[model samples]
Target chain A: MTDWDGRRWHDMGGQAAGPVPMESHDFALWEKRVDALMVLCGQKGLFTVDGLRRALEDMGEEAFETYSYYERWIAAVNQNLIEAGVYATEELAARMAEIAARGPTYGEAQDG
Target chain B: MPHDHPDHDHDHHDHDHDHDHGPFHHEGMSPSGHPYRHDNDSPLTYWQRMEIAVRELLIDKGRITAAEIANQIEAMDARSPTNGAAVVARAWTDPAFKARLLHDASAASREMGFDIGPLNLIAVENTADTHNLIVCTLCSCYPRNLLGLPPDWYKTRAYRTRAVREPRAVLREFGLDLPANTTVRVHDSTADMRYLVLPARPAGTDTLTERELAALVTRDSMIGTGLPLRP
Candidate 1:
């Protein structure tokens, strides 16, 4: 599906759509962390921004509708990192489980 | 479909957190006058968990450092519409710089000591006869290094689609009514190149200093959604 030559779901140019929503919000700490990782990994030559975009596109339209911007971004960043052999999915899953057990809130879960 | 997150609550809350983690302080607005997002107080989300895991894995592998990550975040925070405003103001005043900016935006921006960091930037000039609008039809490919992060609207599917389809109507919604004779050129930001709209200088601004002129340049003007503030 990533190879679809027709207008992909992510490709919204010239398509009929509704009014532009103008509300904006400041990035949360965790969201900023996700953004930093994306930039740092790209700077480190581990992956290109295009690779990140490709991963986001491959995640399909459902993600664009359901997830928040940074959520999708972290997913794409993780996907690219895994594809780049930076870490195994098993390692990621284990770490996630460990984090989840730490606390119910983000403050308690993150390392000091 | 457009995914919309509720605007972050501006009311300050007292959470049960004993101590702050990392560089984020949960008090007051950031230096930029924007309120900090309530991170520690929010419930741990699945995506946040993924972010923590990925960041930790990258750190464990010695691929990136915590300090480096902090520094990068700080750098991005430092970038805002002010940078683009300064550039627009400079172009408004200096003909030579404007020519250089219109010729090569990245170089001109770097010449001003703004490290745009490998972003292929293009400067589109708006004249009396023509106006320029920018949209990333494929994704939100904005000139972020210059203008900071794209606004919430810029990344929306409605904007992404209609900006190219009916830019005039879109601009009208933003309260900008272009004349019928003006040609609207919408720049679709692709994977490699980003665009900055060099909005036409407003009249009666000849006496204003570069800094003062910069104040007239709004972020939406640079994005071509709205005009520069009237002097």
Candidate 2:
């Protein structure tokens, strides 16, 4: 309860957060990997966990709720990577474009 | 995938709308053997694509080896709720261990041979007069070393916002109907520290062994959404 910034959304203590369901679903393969990726990056001195939290905090509100849990992790890690000079933003865009051009290959491959 | 960062400052960065993508396919870019989940909309998700490029680029730059990343992944895979369950079970049977757990949770975990990572771990005991609930209202700042990654429900908007403001009601909805006189204390994990709820030992388990008692400790019990089973 102490040291919470009143204006921050994440500092929500004793706020009307939402309903707490008693169950949880299985984490998808990619979703499970994000933790390790982040830990590895952190262990390499690339960025701190606090830095990653800042990046997550910096995300747009809609984006915060829009993507799945690890999707946000991927975005936050990507942001930190580019900011840390470990990867170029331009390269990321280029690679994304390259894969996008491949045109959803899984369906076609599965059919063949 | 929806993070279209407004600060993405590139004059030529119309990476979104450019449709005249070339028919070029890099030699090793075959979809058949790539490390990707089969999403119908796109073979490789935006995040998967980014991971590949960033992972490769980091490797190319001599920043991190693929082995280290693999090792970390293996470590994460090895972690589970059993780590927390063992800790809680020991505290339930042994009063001295319970004192140590409440005093310094991470050290107590380390004493039990569980690596609790770098963040401080605090064990808040739930007593008859007081109940403790943990939440990371911002993001899912869980004690992964103890309980692994948080369950999907823990990261939901409702849980994040409601855990602090309406804990009693939220807990009730989770099937934890507390006594009206019990004061609920919702711990907000704002920083690096993570909180674990050492739920009150249920009655009639005095004869149960540590391993047998650990079986009664559910993941939600440690999260304070539910209580340990009564045996």
- The numbered model that scores best in DockQ is 1
Model 1 lDDT tens row, B1-231: 355656466675554463434564445666457767666766788998998898889889999988888787778888899999999999999999999999999999999999988888999999989999999999899999988878788999899989999999999999999999999999999868999999999999989999999999999999999999988
Q: Candidate 2: give the TM-score of chain A.
A: 0.79
Worst 10 residues of 1 chain B by lDDT: B18-27
Tell how far residue A80 is off in model 1, in angstroms: 1.3
Indicate the docking level reached by candidate 1. medium
Q: Write the per-residue lDDT of candidate 2 for residues B42-95, one digit (tens) a residue.
A: 355667565556665676789876666556655665677778889999999899
- For model 2, the stretches where C-alpha displacement exceeds 4 angstroms are A1-6, A13-18, A21-23, A98-112, B1-42
lDDT of each: 0.87, 0.71
Interface RMSD of 2: 8.4
The per-prediction CA RMSD against the true structure, in angstroms, equals: 2.5, 9.7
**With candidate 2 superimposed using the best TM-score fit, by how many Å does residue B135's alpha carbon deviate from the native?**
0.7
